[model samples]
Target: MKVLVTGAAGFIGFYVSKVLLEKGHEVVGLDNVNDYYTADLKYDRLNELGISKKEAEIFKRKSVSSKYSSFAFIRMDLEDRTHLPSLFENESFDAVCNLAAQAGVRYSLENPEAYVDSNMVGFLNILECCRNHKIKHLVYASSSSVYGLNEKIPFSAEDNVDHPISLYAATKKSNELMAHTYSHLFQLPTTGLRFFTVYGPWGRPDMAMFLFTDAIVNNRPIKVFNYGNMERDFTYIDDITEGVVRVIEKPINDRLNEKEYYKLYNIGNNNSVKLSDFINEIENNLEKKAEKQMLPIQPGDVERTWADVNGLIRDYGYSPDTPIKEGVKNFIDWYRSYYKI
Candidate 1:
């Protein structure tokens, strides 16, 4: 199958692209390569997939990976009205995994426009292109943050997600709504995966695992938000990639109602580990104690997030099982090797 994976330079997108290539699928990856965190890290991820820094710097040009002939990349934004449609007309992708978006809950508070452009306008472009190109499946990245202010212990796909605490979450929720609209009106098979606290090697610098590991290794203080009272279902990258691959292979069909072609699932670990316990795993792996600075939860921050992935397991025959200790150890090892610490 020929697949188009947006945000291929991103953490999850990189892993997804690598796995797809390994399965002998031809993959065309697209990413804007914005400097929301660090462009060097994004480029490094591309390098791992055989896209050179020189090739990745040029926008809108397709560059094939030297390591995997089936994998190629293009540097472009999702919101580009002209080039996106042109690419769709040219490629005629069999399936599209749309993982590209401006992703930081707290950062959205400072830069609301960025969220609107990438997550809102950018997603619309993806839908339009998929609609026009007759793409078979459109699997997109949503967030557990969409279940904001809900007192539910384990967040389920069936539960109400009408209240999103952050602009990032709002945009993600909006993507789900937009996907349903296209799926209903145009008979597109769309699936939205509400990811939990995703973390592993090649992870984003802004994420908690990366931040805590970096601070601990450097002998700096690690900020404990919510005064050390928080929990998250930190899903591993490998598990996420595997689940996404399965979903891509199995697009929604006419076995259900015509309007029910749209589906949403919580792709998460299903085990919410406490914040202090998660920190302990990192400290244990690094053989160092963190200088902890307890802080109040910032605005747009949720107290806790736990995903109920039974629906995913039932549908996809898979569930995330990586333990927090193992995941943190893998991250710490990668961090030390990457930073020469």
Candidate 2:
């Protein structure tokens, strides 16, 4: 199968692209390579997939990597509807996994426009392309943040997600609604995966795992948000990749009895870990006690998050079993190696 994976330079997207290439599938990766984090880190992720910094810098449409014969990359943004359509028309992608978006929930509070442009306008372009190109299925990245103040311990896709706490969460929830519209109007098959606390090697710098690891290794103070009362389903990257691959292979199809080919699933570890416990794993793995600065939870931050992935397990045999200790160890090892720490 020929697959188009947006956010190819991103953490999850890069891993997913590599796996797909290894499986002998043709993959065309697209990413804007924005500086939400360091562009160097994004470039390094591309480098792992055999894309050169020189090639990435020039906004190349198609760069064939030396390592993966089945892999190609395009430096493009989802908001650029003109180029997006042209690419879709030219490549004729079989399936698309949309992971490109302005991601940070906290950052969204500061820069709301970025979220609107990337998450809202950007997603519409994807839907339009999928609809026009007759793509078989479109799998997109939603967020557990969409469950926002629901007071539900384990969030389900069936639950109403109308009260998103941040602009980021609002946009994520909006994506689900837009996907359903496309699925209904054009009979396009779409699936949205609400990811929860995804972390591992090559993880985003803004996330807690990366932040805490960096601070601990550098002998800097790590900010303990919500006074260390926070809880999260710190899902491992491998588990997320597996769930994504499974969903991609099995495209949702609207039956005579069903309304449309639209579905959503929570891709996360069911086990929730307290903030202190998580930090303990990181500290133990790094052999360094982190200097902690207790802080009140920032706005747009949720007290806790847990995912209900039973639907995923039943439908596609999805199971996330990576322990935090193991995941943190892998991350710490990668961090040390990557930074020469």
Candidate 3:
């Protein structure tokens, strides 16, 4: 199968591309390589996939991977109206895994326009291209944050996500709605996976795990939001990628006769770990105590997030189960080597 994976330079995207290549699928990875956090980290991830920083700089130029012949990459944005359609027409991809989006929830508060451009306008381009090209399957990244302000203990796919606390969550929820429109009208098989607190090696620098680890290593005080009363269903990157691959390969075929081929699932570790416990795992891995600074929860932040992944398990026959301790150890080892700290 030929697959087009958007945001292939990102943490989860890079891992997913690797898995798809291992499965002998010809993959064309795409990314704009924006500097929302660190462009160097994004380039380094591309380097791991055998795409040189030099080749990645050229816009829309497909760079074949030095290691994997089946894997290639293109530096481009999802919102490119002209180029995106051309690429779809040329490549005629069998499936598309749209993981590209402006990610941080808090960052959306500062730069809401970024979210509108990438998550909203950009996603519309993807849907248009997929619909025009008649792509078989379209699997996209959603977020657990969409279940904002809901008092539900375990967030489920069926739960009402109409009220989102953050702009980022609202955009993600909109993506689901937009995808459903295409799925129903054009018979496109679309699946949205609402990811939980995803963390592991090659993780984003803005995330809690990376921030806390970096601050702890440098002897800086780490902020404990919500005064250390937060819990998250932190899912590992490998597990997330595996579930994505499964969904991409197996599209929604149950409702082929009815043209109701849209679905959503929560991809996360079913167990929710307390914030203090998660910090303890990081401290254990780094062998350094963190100077904690308890603070009130920032705006656009949720008190806790717990994913009910039964829908994913029932449909894909897979669930994220990486223990927090093991995931933290892997991340710390990678961080030390990457930073030489």
lDDT of 2 by residue, 1-341 (tens): 99999999999999999998888899998999999999999999999999998888767468999889889888988899689999999998999999999999999989999999999999999999999889999999999999998987788878989898999999999999999998889988999999999999999999999999898877899999889999999999999999998788765653223556888899989988999999999889888799999999999999999888898888877679899989999999999899987
Shift of residue 227 alpha carbon in model 1, Å? 0.5
The superposed Cα distance between candidate 2 and the true structure at residue 219, in angstroms, equals: 1.5
Q: On residues 1-341, what C-alpha lDDT tens digit does candidate 1 reach at each position?
A: 89999999999999999999999899999999999999999999999999999999999999999999999899998889999999999987999999999999999999999999999999999999999889988999999999999888899999999989999999999999999999989988899999999999999999999999889888899999999999988999998999899898785773346557799999999988999999999999999999999999989888888999989888777899999888899999999999988
* Model 3 Cα lDDT, one tens digit per residue, 191-302: 9999999999999999999999999988899999999999999999989999999998875675344556899999999988999999999998888899999999999889
For each candidate, the alpha-carbon lDDT, in order, equals 0.92, 0.91, 0.93
Model 3 quality (TM-score): 0.98
Give the per-residue Cα lDDT of candidate 2 at 233. 93
| RMSD after CA superposition, every candidate | 1.0, 1.3, 1.1
Residue 9 local lDDT, model 1? 95
